[model samples]
Target: MDTDIFSLRGRNIVVTGAAEGLGRTFALAFARRGAFVACVDIDPAVEETCALIEKNGGKALPLMADVSNEAAVTTMAAQLEASADTLHVLVNNAGIAIPPGRLLDVSVANWDRVIATNLRSVFLCSKALLPMLLRSKDASIINLSSFLALVGLYPGFEITAIPYASSKAGVDGFTRQLAIEYARDGLRVNAIAPGWHGGTRLGRERQASSEPAVIKRFNDFIQGSIPMGHMGTPDDLTGLAVYLASSASRYVTGQTFAHDGGLTAA
Candidate 1:
C-alpha cells in the first residue's frame, strides 16, 4: 500500500555499459529517481553519461573498465568502496554480438570471446561486488539477457549471431544459480530479456535500410509480429528495473522477466 516502497533515494547503483543505448537509459532513470549512479563503460562516453546525470541534478560517477576483465571489475568494487560504503544495485548490461555465423562456422576463439563478454563479465562483476551488496540491507543484481534466449529468435534481428543467443541463454542460467546462492544474503539476482527496440541491431534494420520501401517492410514485419502492435522503448523497461532494484521486489528473486512485447509469447 505504501507507494514509497519503490523509492531509490540515497541508494548507490552501478550500471555497466552506460555510455549509450539501454545502459545509458537505465543510468539516467535511476539517477532521476534519486539514486547515486555509477556509470561504467569501456568507452570514454561514459563520462558523458555521468555529466548528463549531474546536469539533471542527480549524483553520478564515471568508471571506465572492461567488465570481462577480473582486475578491472575488482577495481570498480574498490572504487565503489571509496565513493560509497554500500552498493544497493548492480546492472550488468555490457554485451556484444558475435559474428553472424552458425554453430559450425563460429570459431572456438569467437565462442570464447562471446562467453567472456556476455556471461563471464556478469560473474566477475557480481563476484567482485558481492561483499558490498551483502553489506546492504537490500541489494539487487539485474543481468541483461535477450528474448532470443527465450525463443531463439534471430533471423529478423539485425544483430544476428549464434554466440549472442547462446551467451544470453547462459546469462539466464547464471542468474538462477546466483540467486539461490545469495538468497540468504538478501541479494536478489534476476534478469531482463528485452524485445525489439529502435536503436539496437534489429531496431536499426527498420531505420537504416537501403531504401524506404525496404525499411517500411521491416517495420511492417515487426508490427505484425509483436502482439503489442509495435516494439518497446528504453523507458518501457524503467519501471520494471526500478521495481526489481527497490524493496518493492524484496519478495522476488531468481527470476528472468521478459520485456519483449509478447515476442517470446507468440
Candidate 2:
C-alpha cells in the first residue's frame, strides 16, 4: 500500500517560505523524492536553498515574492504555469510571529501585518494557483497550521498577541471550505496543526539562551510535559506530509492532521 501510494515522482511542488525552517525542509524532501520543487520565499536566503537543491542533483527554482501580496502571487502563478503547466502540490508554509502583546495593547499595524503575512497569504497563493491545481490529475493544498489553533495556546513567549492564533484558526477553517468546494475536481485541501516543533528563530533562542538554569528548567518541563516526552524535529513531519501529498491520502480531505507528538492526543 505504501509503495504505490507515497510516490511523488514527476510531480511539481511549490513550497512557500522555503528559505529556512520547516519550509526548507519540506521543499528539500519533495525534491529528494523526484519532484520539480519551486522554492518561494520573501528572503534572499532562498537562493542558497536553491543552490543546495541543485547541488544535490535535484531540480529546483527559487522565486522571491511576498506571499501576502496578491499581485506577487499572481505573477508567480503565471510563471509557474508557463513552466510546469500544472502544480501537483501546494505547501502554504509562510508565516510571521509578531512581538508578544495583549490583544488590547497590540497595535493595529501589527495585527494587519500578522493577518496579511500569516493568513491572507494562504488565500492569495491558493486562489492564484487554483486554476493550475485544477488542471492537475491530482492536486493537494497543504496549509501549515499550529497546535495553538487547536488547543488555544496563544500568547507565545514572545507575544501575547491574539492575531497569530486567530489567523491560524482562520487557516484551519479555510482548509475545510476549500476541500469541500474542490473535492469534486480531484483537489484535496488539508491543514497540518503541528505541535511545538522547535524551528523558529525564537525557539532556537529559547534553547540556546545564556540563562542556562532557566533554559534547563524549561527543557525539563517540556520533556516531561509533552506526552511524547520531547520536542519534535522538522523531519518528524515528513511521513505525514508525504501521505497528504501523494496518493496515499486519496480519501483524506477537509481535515487537520495534528502532528504534535502526542500533545494533541494527551
Candidate 3:
C-alpha cells in the first residue's frame, strides 16, 4: 500500500467556481496535496480562497472570469498559459441552479441562463484549455454534475429546477464523449454527481425562496429518501476529488460517480 500514488506534488490545477462551496473545497484540497492551484471565479471573493491556500503554505493564483462567457474563458486560458507551461488537472466545478420551479412555470430566459452557465461553461473551458492540458503527461478533467441529472424529483416538490437537471444531463453526455475522444491522448474526463448536500448556496437559495411548510416538507422528504438518513457536506466529496485528480485513478475515465448519501442506491 504505497500512498505515494496519491501525491499531486508539483502538478498544476485549475478549479472554477472556487469563490465558495465545493469549488473552494476542491481548490484547497489540491493545494494541500502540493499542487499549484489556480482558483477561477467570476466573483472577486476568489481572492479569499487563494489567500486561505497561501495562509496554509500552499501556492495559489486567483483568476477572475465568467466561465460561461466564451471571450472571458479565452482570456482566462491565455492568462493561465502564460503562468504555466502545462495544466495537469482541470475541475469544471462552476455551475448555477435557478430558483426551483415546475417546467412550464419556468421562464425561457432562466432556462437558457442555466444551460449557458452549467453546460456551456464546461465546453468553453475545456476547449480553451485543451492545448495546455495536452502538454501534461497525465491530464484529467473533472466535471461537477448532480444526481438530479439521473432521476426526477417527486411531482410538486419543486425541489429541483428543470433547467438545472437538464444541464447536468448534458454534462454527463459531454463527459463520456470527450473521454473517448481524448483517451488516445492520455486525457481522462469524468464527472461527479453529487446528491443532497447541505451547506451549499443552492440549498440556501431554495430554502430562502420557499415557505416554511414547503421547506419542512422538502427537508423531511430528502432525509427520508437517503438511506444514510443524513445529508453530506462539502468535505465528503474532497476524498473522491483527490482520487480523481491523482495518479491513483490514472486508469479511470469517462465515469460519473454519485456522492449521494446512498440516495441513488435506495
Candidate 4:
C-alpha cells in the first residue's frame, strides 16, 4: 500500500569495492534514492565515491579496508556501526579475476587468493555485519556473482577461469544457504550474476596481456555470442541492485538474477 516500498529512503547501505566500476555506480545509485551509503574499499579511490555522493546531496562514508581480511572486515563493520545504528543493505561486490590459465599450471596459492577475495570476503562481510542488518525492519544482502558461476564460459575460457568460476559458484551456494537461514528474520539474500560489461574491467586486467588485435577479435566473438548482440553497461545493473535492496524485493530470496544481456540465456 505504501509507495515507498520501492524507495531506499533513510536506509543504511554498505557497498564493498566501492572505489570504481560497478561498485561505485551502485553506491551512487543507492544514495540518490536516499540510502546513506558506506563506501568501503582497500583503495583510496573510494574517497571519490564518497565525494560524488555528498556532491549529489546524499549521505556517504568512505571506509578503507580489505574485505578479504577477517580483522579488516570486522573493523569496517564496527566503524560503520559506530555511526549508523542499523544497516539495511549490503552489496558484496569486491572481487578479482586472475589471468586465465589451466589448473595444471595454477598454483595453490593463486587459487587461495582468488577464492579469498571472490568468496571469503562475502562470508566475512556478511558475518561481521549481520547483527546490524538484523536490527533493521528490512534488510538485504546482495552478492556479486558472475555468469561464469551459472555455466562454464563456453570452453577455452574455462581453462583460465576455474579459480574465478569456482569462487563465484561458491557465492551462489552461500547466498542460498544464508537467505534460507535468515529469511525468517526479515533478511533477504540474493546474488547478481552479471555478464561482461563494456567499461567495467569485467576482467580487462587479464585481457590487457593480450594484443589489441586479439582483444578486438575476442570482443567481437563475445558480443556475437550474446543474444542481445551487444555488450552491457555498468548502469544496466543499477536498476536491479536498487530493486533487490529496497522493499520491492522483500518477497524474493535465494535467487540469482543474471544481468548479462542474455548471454546466460543463450
Candidate 5:
C-alpha cells in the first residue's frame, strides 16, 4: 500500500498546548512526517518541544500565549502570520480540567475557566488561523475532545469535573458547525475524543487534588471500565492525529473519532 497519502511533507501545522502531554506528542509526530510545526502554549516549556523537534531534524517554531485570552491569541496569530505564508493543519489541544466534585459545589470561577480554556480557545485559535488555513489546498483543524463529552460517569465513579465534560461537548458542536460552514472553502474540521489516557497533566492534576480514597476509586474505574482493560498513553493517539491531519483523511470532516481502548464501545 502506498503511504504517500499520509505524508505531511512541506505542510505547515500549529499545535496548541504543546508544552507537554498530548500536544507535545502531536507536534513531534507531525515534524517527523515532514511538517513544519508551530508549538504554541502559555508555558515556557513550549520551547522544549521545539528543541526536541529541531534535535530530530524537524522544523518547529515555539509561540507562547494564553489561548483562552483573545488578545493573546490575536498576538499569536500575528506572530504565526509573519512566519509562514500558509497553514495546513491546526491542532487545538490546549485544555484543562478542574478536580472532580459535586456539581453544587462547583464554583462559577472554575466553570468559566474550563469553558474558556477548552471551548473558547478552539474558537479563538480557529478563527484567528482560518485565513492562513484557507490559503492551503488541504487544510484541516483537529480539536481535542473527551469521552466525558458523550457520556456521563456513573454515580460514585465521577473522576472528571462537570465543567470539563460541558466544555468538550461544546467542542464537538463547534467542530461540526465550523465544518459545515467551511466545506465550500475546502476546509476539514474534526475532533479526537480520547478516553482515560494516562500520562497527561490533566490526569496528574486530578490525582494530586483528590483524596487517597477518591484516587483509589478512580483507578478501579479505569481498570474495570475499559473493555481493553487498560488506560491509553498519549502515543496511542498519534497515528489517528496524523491521519486526520494528512491527505489520507481528505474526505473526512465534521466527525469525532474515539481512541478509547473500547471503553466507549463497551
Candidate 6:
C-alpha cells in the first residue's frame, strides 16, 4: 500500500487542548506527516508542544487561549489568519471532566464547566473557523467524543462521569448535524470515541496523589473490563486522526469511530 495516501503534506491543522495528552500527541503526529500544525490550548504548555514539533523539523504555531471564550476564539482565528490563510483541519479536542459521578457527585459548577469546555468550544471553534476551513478544497473537523457516550457503565467503567459522558454525547450529535449542514460546503465532520487510555494529563493531580496500591487496583479493574486486556495509549489515535484529517477519508463523514480496542464491540 502506498503510505503516501495518508500524508498530510502542506495541510494546515488546528488542534485544541494540545498542551498535553491526546491533543499534544495529535499535533505532533500531524506535524510529522508534514502538516503545518497550530497547537491551541488554554495552557501555555502548548508552547512546549509546538517547540517539540519544531525540534523535529516540523512547523507549528502555538496559540494559547480559552477555547470556551468567544473573544478568545475570535482572537485565535484572527491570529491564525494572520499566520496562514487556509485551515484544512480542526481537531476539537479541548475538554474537561471533573467533579464526576451521578447527580450526588456532580455539581452545577462542574456540569457547567464540562459543557462549556467540551460542548460549547466545539461549536465556537468550528463556527469561528468555518470561513477559513471553507477556503480549503478539502476540509475536515474531527471532534473528540468518548465511549461513555454510547454506554452507561459503573463499578468498572466510567464510574461517576455523568458530565463527561453527557458532553461527549452532545459532541456526537453535533458531529452528525454539522456534517449534514456542511456537506454542500465541502466539509467532512466526524468524531473519535476513545476508551480506557492512559498517560493523559486529565486527573493528573489525582493520580499523582494516589497510593500505589490504590492506583494498581484501579488499573487492574479497568483493564479487566476491556476485552483487549489492556488500556490504549495516546499514540493509538494517530492513524485514525491522520486519516480523517487527510483526503483518505474524503467519502467519510458524520461517523464516530470508537478506537476502544474492541470494548465497544461487547
- lDDT (0-100) at residue 237 of candidate 3? 94
TM-score of candidate 5 on Cα atoms, chains taken together: 0.97
Please provide, for model 4 over 101-193, each residue's C-alpha lDDT reduced to its tens digit, 9 standing for 90 to 100. Answer: 777768899999999999999999999999999999689999999988998764444324688999999999999999999989989999999
Model 4 ranges off by over 4 Å: 155-160
For each of the candidates, the C-alpha root-mean-square deviation to the true structure, in angstroms, is 2.7, 2.6, 1.5, 1.6, 1.5, 2.0
TM-score list, all predictions: 0.91, 0.91, 0.97, 0.96, 0.97, 0.95
Candidate ranking under TM-score, highest first, comes to 3, 5, 4, 6, 2, 1
Residue-wise C-alpha lDDT for candidate 3, range 1-266, written one tens digit per residue: 34698888988999999999899989999999999999999999999999999999999999999999999999999999889989999999999998777888899999999999999999999999999999996899999999998888864567777999999999999999999999989799999999988887677777788899998888888778899998999999999999999999999999999999888787
lDDT of 6 by residue, 52-152 (tens): 99999999999989999999999999999999999999999998878435667777888899999999999999999999999997899999999988888
lDDT against true structure, model 2: 0.85
| lDDT digits (tens) for residues 1-266 of candidate 1 | 44698888988999998998789999999998899999998999999999999999999999999999999999988987899989999999988765445667788888888889889999999999888888896899999999888886445534356788889999999999999988988899999999777665335533553467766765787888899999888889999999998898999989999998888888
Q: Which stretches of candidate 5 lie over 4 Å from their true place?
A: 1-3
Q: 7-126 in candidate 5: lDDT tens per residue?
A: 999899999999999999999999999999999999999999999999999999999999999999999999999999899999999999887776986999999999999999999999
Candidates ranked by lDDT: 5, 3, 6, 4, 1, 2
The superposed Cα distance between candidate 6 and the true structure at residue 258, in angstroms, equals: 0.5
Task: Candidate 6: list runs displaced more than 4 Å.
Answer: 1-3, 156-158, 203-206, 209-214
Error of 4 at 116 (Å): 0.5
Residue 213, model 1: Cα distance from true site in angstroms: 7.8
Top candidate by lDDT: 5
Candidate 1 ranges beyond 4 A from true positions: 1-3, 154-159, 200-218
Worst 10 residues of 4 by lDDT: 152-161
lDDT of 2 at 128: 94
lDDT agreement with native, every candidate: 0.86, 0.85, 0.93, 0.90, 0.93, 0.91
